[model samples]
Structures are given as C-alpha cells and as structure tokens.
Target chain A: MTKTFDIVFALWPRCAQLDFLGAYEVFAHLPGANLRLASEHGGDLTGALGLPLRDVEKLSDIERCDLLFVGGTADMSAATTPGMLQQLRRLGEDARYVTSICTGSLILGQAGLLRGRRSATHWAFLDQLAQYGAIPDPARTVRDGKFWSGGGVTACVDFALELMADIEDPTYAQMIQLYIEYNPAPPFGSGHPSTAPAEVVEALRARFGEKLGKIGGVVPTTALT
Target chain B: MTKTFDIVFALWPRCAQLDFLGAYEVFAHLPGANLRLASEHGGDLTGALGLPLRDVEKLSDIERCDLLFVGGTADMSAATTPGMLQQLRRLGEDARYVTSICTGSLILGQAGLLRGRRSATHWAFLDQLAQYGAIPDPARTVRDGKFWSGGGVTACVDFALELMADIEDPTYAQMIQLYIEYNPAPPFGSGHPSTAPAEVVEALRARFGEKLGKIGGVVPTTALT
Candidate 1:
C-alpha cells in the first residue's frame, strides 16, 4: 500500500472534459497513487478550454508505467499519426492494464491492439472499431481481458470505478464510490444514444459519420457544412 | 456575435478537474457559442483519473481569447512568482471574462483582483479568501457585477450554467443543460457542508487543510476553520 501505483496517460490537444477528468477523479484520489501526465513535451498543455496545463511529464518514460491510459482527443488527426500509432502499438507490449476513454479506443484500434478483440468507445466513435475488425460494444464499460474501455465522455467515471475494482479490492472501490458521491441522477437521462433527442441524435450522426468513415479508409469530410 | 469566445483554461500539475472543466463544459457547449481550449503548451493536461486533455489553441497567443480560466492547482509555489501574478492581472484587463475553478479563485485572489470583492470558492478554501480580502459567499455561484464565481468543483458547473444565462440565451443555457445531461444526482445527498455526514465533512477538512494553511497569502484558513 505504501508503494505508488505508476500510471501513464496520453495527453493531446482538444480532448473533451469528461474524457480526461472523469477517470482522473478516481485514479488521482486513490489513497496511494502516484499519477503522472506523460506528454511528448514537458510542462503544461492546454485543454479545449482556454486554460494552462502545467502537469505534463515526459513521454519517454511511458514504458515504466504499470497502468497506461490513452486519451481520446478532439483532434482525430493526432491519433492518425504514424508516430503516435506506432507508439501505441509498442505500448501494448509494455502495459499491464491498457484502457481508453471516449474515442481513445480508436487510438488503441489504430495501434492494431483491437484486431479481433472486443472493446467499447465513445458513442461518437464506436463504429471506428469495425475498421480494425474488432467487435464494438455499447456498454458504458467493456472489459475484454486486459483491454478496458468506456463508451463516452462521462462513462469514464464508471469505467474507472470498475478499474479501481479490478486493480484493488471491490470493497475499496465501493467505499470510494460512496465517498465521492458516485450515485448519479442524470437530470435528462440523455447520456445514451437511445435517450437523446432526435435532433440531437441526428446532430451526433452528422458529426460522427465522417470520423467513422475515415477508418474504413474513406476520405473524411473536408468541410462540416 | 462578432466577438470571439476562445476560453483558455490553464492545466497545471496536480490540478483539480472540476475547477478547470466544470465551467468549461457549460460555456463551451452552449449552443451557437464558439469555444476553444487554449493549451498553454499544446497538449492535454491529465487529471484525477488519468484522462487526457486535448486543447484547441496555445497560450502563446493569449490575446485572441475573450476569457481565460485557471483551475486550483496543487503546485501554487510555481504560480506565486511575481511575473505570473502580473501576467494574470494583465489578462483580467484584456479578457472580457476571467475566471477560475475550485481554488482557482485563489489565483485571481493572488492577482489582487478579488480585493474587497464578494466572490465564491470551494468551501474548504473559504479561509484563504481573507488573504486577498475577498468576502466568501456560501452560495454555489456568486455574481458581483462582472466577476462570476462558484464554490468548489461541482458548483463551478452550476455557476457556469447560471452565468451562461447572461452571456448566452437562457434557452440556450437550458438546452445545454439538456445536452450535457446536467441533472446531477449525488447518491450521498450531501455536497454542501450543512447536510454532509460529520466524518465526510471532517475528511474534507483534513485533506484540504494544507490548501487552507499553505496558500496563506490568498487564503487564511484559521479564521474560517
């Protein structure tokens, strides 16, 4: 219990809020955890909000992490980079527990770790799994062996809770859940695809279509209009 | 409509998530609003659960933003530098909206902006307010003319939603509440000090005591504790 749990997470530009912090909330607050935000560069990174990121650690040390988490960023192009893809592929060999939030599963997919594996991703990017010939699940959390994942931005909290269960005792996870007030009463019950409004669903479809199409090797949308 | 609302949030090492992203979610996703995260160093700042942050812009061009937000960061030592405080005060003059998450109010307090102003912050840090002579309000969100502030992590979200009523159409704010699924249901039924279990309340006090004691110039804990 005295030793810190070594964790490494990928940091990029334009990631959604819940994607990063939902999980961060559970992990960083764990009693004896030593968390590090590993980036390509040292120092702070900006979030999609106009804010300063002062917690960036070096990416060169990723191999040392016991649990490695990959972030699903807003900028899809960053995930498509050969360098990033290769690094992710290499990460598979080193990571004990590999997980993702939102479209981060796509980065895992692009890394070739998802081939023939079952996983889940952000509702917006779930279809991207098919491009890698992997089975996609819509569950808030999907755990297929060592590959743990969440479905959308907010789902990360649940995923991390489950991860905490897997990493530690279920009792501890349950205790933390209570301590953090994990019981959520979502006002609208619209976090899922089924509950969202038709217009909202359509907007999601219109927005997600091209991102999914790109992995099938189709040319992505050049303009959103 | 002609103005640009590029809100840059600063992500510092060991920064709290709710303070940084709580307000960002309300403003960024408001319908018809164009929000961008200006990554100070150009990558995601990892938080509580090892989630990654992807930013849309960089801090090198801080002038482009209409609002700038900084979250409560653990390493206040680094931000206490004279130039840093001066830079923030300067941003307060240029930016239309300048805010903070959680203890982020302390940064503003340090910048000399909260002098004799009625503001809101996480209850744990209420004592810290006296350092800057900011009158702490127990409300979730307090509005003193242009300075919109919120108490603690989750309160930032509520405060942001309330502020959006002014900056965005009220209907749009409601729509955003619908979109982001803003209805919160805390299972414990205790987020405020008045209703929380005594142990839980004490735990909060113990954990945040250093923040209360250490961040002296911005907050003097003895008076409030």
Candidate 2:
C-alpha cells in the first residue's frame, strides 16, 4: 500500500487553469501527494497568466501512480512534440485512473486513448476530439468507467471530487467539502454565454476575442442551475 | 470603481494551496480581474507538493482589490514578517473584501485584521485563531459579518465562489462549478485530522513533527472542540 501518489501534468507556456491547478486540488489529497509538473527538461515554464513555475521534476523519473492527468493545451494546430504523445500513452496505461481537463482532453485523444470512447473537454476545444472518434460530452465531467474527461478548467475540481469518492470514501469527499465549504454563491445571474448579459458575454468574448470563430458550439451552462 | 484587483498573498519557498488558488478563482472574476500575485519577492515560490510558483508580484504594488487573501504559514512563529503586517493593515482599510483561508486567517489575525472577528482555518490548526482573539468556525467557509474566513485550503475555492457571487454573477459560480465538473471523488476517505487514519494523522504529525509547542493551543483540540 503506497501512501504517496504522483499525478503528472504536461507543461506548456500557455496552459489554462484546468490544465494545472484545476486537477492539482484533487491530487493534493493523497497521503503524501507528490505533484510532479513535468516538462521536457524540468525547470521553469511560464503559465498562461504569466506566472512562471520552476523546480519541475523531469517526466522520465515518474515511474507509476494511482492517477495520471493529461492536462490540456491551448495550441492544437501546433504539431505534437516528439515522444510527448507517446509518453502520455505510456502513463495512461500504467496509472490506475487516467483523465484530462479542457484542451488536455485533446492531448489524451491525440495519444489514441479516447478512440471510440466518450470524453469531455473545454467547450471551445471539443471539436478537436472528433478526429479521435470520441463521443464528446459537453457536460462538466464525463466518466466512461475508467476513462474520465473534464469539461472546462473549473470542472476539474468536481471531477476530482468524484474521483476522490471512488478512490477514497464518499465520506472523505463530503468531509473535504465540509472542511473546504463547498457551498457556492454567484453574484451575477449568468455564468454561461446564454445567461450572461450581452455586454458581459461580449466582455468575456473580448477577452478571448482572438480565439473566436475557430471553435464549434455555444458557451457553457450554469452547473448548479 | 475600477474592476482591477490586487490579490495579496505571502509567497516563499513553500506556501500552501488553499491560500493561493482558492482566492485566485474568485478574484480573477472581477470585471477586469487583473490579478497581481503579491509575494515578498517577485520570483518562484514553491508550494506544498513540490509545485513551484514564480513571477509573483511584489507586495509593494497593492493599491486596492476586491479581496485580499492572507495565506497560512508553515513557520508561523518565525513566519510573521514585519512590514507585511503593516502592508496588510494599510490594505485592510480600503479593500472591498478582506478574506483569509486555512492558516491565512491566522496571518490576517496577526495583521490585526481578525481581532474580535470570526475566521476559519485547517481543523488541525483552527484553535490557533483563538490565540489572536478571533472566533474560529468549523464550516468550510466562515463569514464574520463582512470578513470572509475559509476553512482549510480546499475551502478557499468554496470561499472564492462565495465571494465571486457577491461581486460577479451568482450563475458564474454555478457555471464554474458545472464547467469544472466540481463533483469530487477522493481516492481515500481521509483529508482531515479527524477522519484520516490514526497512522496517517501520526505520520502528518511526524512530518510537521517539529511544530514548536508555543502554539500548543493550536495543536490540542480541547478548546475548539
């Protein structure tokens, strides 16, 4: 019985929250959760928000774990790096549970893990999964038994909790919820594209303005509502 | 009036999680959500679990923010840096929301922000809040009137969602909950001192084994329970 668990994630210069911290929380629970942020060389990689990360463990050293997360990437057009996709397939096969969030789902798909499977990704990037023959789940987190796919970045937490329930005890998840206070409150009436005011939606659009027209489908729906 | 926010946090070699990302999600939702991860120095600060963070904004730039999350310290007796308390006091005067999570609530108390106020922290350290004349709440997220105190690290996300509801749209939190697929599934049934196996708890004690006895009250649950 191993007390420690190592959850691995890919490092990109522009990975989103779902790619990193989103799933990081769930992995944080293992007895001595050894989180490994792996890159080609393992040093410093700038995150999407300009936060530079350092002291990453080289990917090769990670041998096995109870969980492995193939974090999504924003760049789909860019060619997959040499051996990266191959490495993901290897990790996915070894870990007890394999999952992905947002565009990372695409990364897993690219690795041939989701072929003929049902999976989820960030709404903006779901189309990429089509080439992999995965049944796209627009929902927050989708689980096809052992294969888990997270919808958006934040969806990782919810999926993580569900994973917690499966791996640990249901009560453990509830206890964490009690400890962390899972109660939610929303200020605006809108969280999805449909509910947001035209201006608020546009405001969000303007923020991601550069990436529009490339993806398929509408915005996300409020989970609780 | 400006949606710009300054998120002040203590950053060093190894900071806690709930302290960093929990509030980030909420603060990032403000209109512009222009976040500044204020640290003692503007460089990499490794967090628990070997996750390293970098490019932190220096503490000097905090002008105003919707919320200021004071993270907990691994070395509290040696932890209270001098000028930071002063800066916190200065920021406390004008910030729209003054919040803390896990041990961060203690930092807020040391900054004189938690006096006569109720706050929250990891259950393992909740009793410590009483040392600074603040009431501790067992709930995942605790609010003393206007002050928002979060229990443990994971609770920070819940607290952030609550705060987000106040400032942004209530639905956005729901959307975030749904988007992230917050449904949790912990592999083990333990994340807290009470529920974790006796050996696990003892192991943790051995790990933080050197926690000085000065905060004896914080360690023993007799007073808080």
Candidate 3:
C-alpha cells in the first residue's frame, strides 16, 4: 500500500485568506495527501475580508499528522489567541513536519518551536522574531530541521511548491506549478519595501509602525485592527 | 455619502479555489466595495481539494451588481448546472462589468456574453472558445468592452490587480499589491506550456485530452475524481 500523508491546516478567525489557501492549492494535488482544515473553534470561521471558512475540524482532535500548516491573520495580535497557541504548540510537537506562511512563523515562535532556529516571516515582522528566540531569516522560505517557514501572503504558493519538492519529488512540484499556471507578471513591480518607491515604503512603515512595534501580545485583537 | 460598488462573485461547487480567492484578496480591500460570494446553493460550498467555502449568498436575490466575477472548476463539465447557467446569464446581463478567471470564461460563453468578443481562458481551453463565437486571445487577461477574462488559476491575482488599477486607481492597486506581497518567486519555471519542458507539456495534453474535446456535459465525475 502507498503511504498516505495526513496534512492539517490550522484555520482561525481573521486568518489571512491567501496565506492558507495558496498553500492548500499546491499541497492538495500531492499524490497521497489527506488534507484537512482545523481550528480551535470548529465549524465556520471568518477570515480576513469577510471570507468564510466552512466545516473546520477542532485542532485538539487532530492529534497526529504528517504536516501541520498555520497561516497568518490580518491582525497579528489577534493571531495568538491563548487556546490557539496551545493547540498549535501541541500539534507542532506531534507533526512530522511543522510549517507556516507569513506571520504564522510568529505563532510558531510564540509556541517555542522557533527557539534557536532560523526562521522566516512577513518582512514587516522579521525583526520581531528575536523576541521569541528565533533567528530571523529574510529569505522567501526557510527550513530548519523539521520546521519550515515562508515569507508573507503570496509566498505560500512558492513555499508549498518548495515543500512538495522536498517531501515528494521535483517533477511533482513542477507539474503542480504548471497545473496552476504559476507564472506571475506584476505590472508595477513594487511588492516589497525594497522594490517599492521610497515614499510608498515610508508611508507603509508609518502606517504599520504601531503593529510592527507590538508584534505579539496578551491583549488579543490589538494589532492590525 | 461615498459611492459603493456592489461586487458579486458567482460561486458553484468545485470552483477552482485559487481562481476566486486570489481575485477576492485584491477586491475585498477596495474602498467602498461591497463584496459577496453568491451561488445557487447559497450556503456552504465545496471548492477543489474539498476546501469549504462558507456563507455564500443566493444568486437569485442579487438583481444587480457593479461587477460579476466567475471562476473555473477542474471538471468544466461539473461547473455549469442548468440553474447556474441561467443565474449567470441573468447576472452577466445586469452587471456593468462582467469578468471571469480561468475557464470561467466558458461559463460567460454559455451565457451568450462572449459572442464576437475577444477574450481569454485557461491556455488548455483557449481554442474551445471558437465554438462559442468568442475570439480567444492567449494573453493572461483580455478586455473587450465590459467583458474581462483571464488565463488559469493564479492569473486571477494579476487579473484583479489590473482590474483594480482600471476600476479605481493605480495607487490603490499598488498599495494592495504591497499588502499582499504580490512578488512571486517560483522555484521552477514551468507555469505555461511554452515554458515547461516538452515532455511535461505532452504529458499534460494527454492527461487532459478527453476533457478538452468535450466542452461541458454529463461526463460522470470520473474525469478528475
């Protein structure tokens, strides 16, 4: 019999829509993947932009899995709900591969999985990784032992394809890329602060300065709200 | 009072997850944009990979909308139920701007909106547009009058970004691009048939050969199931 890999995606209220779904798109096509979405509050959960995620399983019940994926939320502060952090920590310890996209690395940091590990997160929150004893890496995706992390929202697609190459084969990853037509052609070419105009970067820094300073908190719902 | 643009996304079972959500990630952030996911089922709908979409509105209730967005499904045969084609035809006529991502353009063709229009669809299905009296342009996105169409799944993100620049302003579109970190770095360059290896393209053509021949029909779920 072929080996079937159980994959769990940790869904939560206000999670960034692209971060989770982008990865799901790539991973779902893997040969033996048994994919499932889980959250602390099962059933329906709302993501950023009022997008609804339906019929999510309880994270606590998903005790064992091959891979566990956690995605970011619009509000970084609300990302680490106390129960959610606990569930993530438990699942992180259990899964063969622990993974995240964007600020999801922050949740891994909060759960102590990133301690002394080189990790990646959204560029806006890269420096904040140090607070949780994580060595911040600015690469698009970073892998340290069993833990894998990727930068920002759309990075999830690249991260998933890379992960597939590691877990399966390079051919499988390339095939899935072709399946989704992953060729991107951005007209403006200003996706990052480094690439964007100076004034646009400054305006964004000022706009996100408050959230950047307070990366994670016990207050919940305070950041990016 | 500020002007509000009522945007409706026409949804159905097994719609390509990335096709709709990628566009949603962009348009949801637009100022005064009232967004909704509407379908015949009107509640929880399953997308590809068994991913659940929550709280969709009924299509019959939405009499008018500024933009009506449609997305493709893996099996285009399963995409258009009789009632769904009716709803699409009604809404496509009412919407100021009618748009689609991937093979969703096929639905618009069925609705008679694509007659003599230069449009785009997934590269694999591009030639099939000739059957519906639509001129198929293999570009990622094409615009003829009020009808807008895009290539495959990930192309929806580029399609939405372009739409935002046209509908609102380039500044707003660029800002959203930054927020989502629209920069893409694919590990392998095999997104299109032209770029992918000859063997891979041949394999895909053989894999999808039958479905391509039959546009939409009662081809039992055996194709991609």
- Per-residue lDDT tens digits for candidate 2, residues B73-115, read 5555423566666667777767877887777777777777778
- Using TM-score as the yardstick, the better of models 1 and 3 is 3
CAPRI-style docking class of model 1 based on DockQ: incorrect
Give candidate 2's error at residue B225 in angstroms. 25
The 10-residue segment of model 2 chain A with minimum total lDDT is A216-225
Residues B1-225 of candidate 1: C-alpha lDDT, one tens digit per residue:
655566656554345665656676667665445555543444555554444555535455566456767667555654444555665676676777777656778777887888888877766566777778788876666777667777666556666767676776554455455444344433243455566656655555555446444422344222121
Would you list the clashing residue pairs of candidate 3? Answer: none
- Higher-scoring candidate on TM-score, 2 or 3: 3
- All candidates' TM-scores? 0.67, 0.74, 0.92
DockQ of 2: 0.25
Task: Name the runs in model 3 displaced over 4 angstroms.
Answer: A203-225, B206-225
**Candidate 1, residue A173: how far the Cα is off, in Å:** 6.1
lDDT, candidate 3, A1-225, per-residue tens: 168999999887787888989999999878789998898889988887788877889988886899999898656555677777788888889888999888888777877778999998887778877878989999989999999999989999999999999998887688778878888888678787778887766655555456444422221322211
lDDT by residue for model 2 (A15-120), tens: 5654568567556765556677776556777665555677766666677666778666545432145456666677788888888887777777777788888898
Docking level for model 3: medium
Instruction: Give candidate 2 misplaced runs (Cα > 4 Å).
Output: A1-4, A58-66, A77-79, A123-128, A137-141, A161-225, B1-3, B60-66, B73-75, B122-128, B135-146, B168-225
Sorting all predicted structures by DockQ, with the top scorer first, yields 3, 2, 1
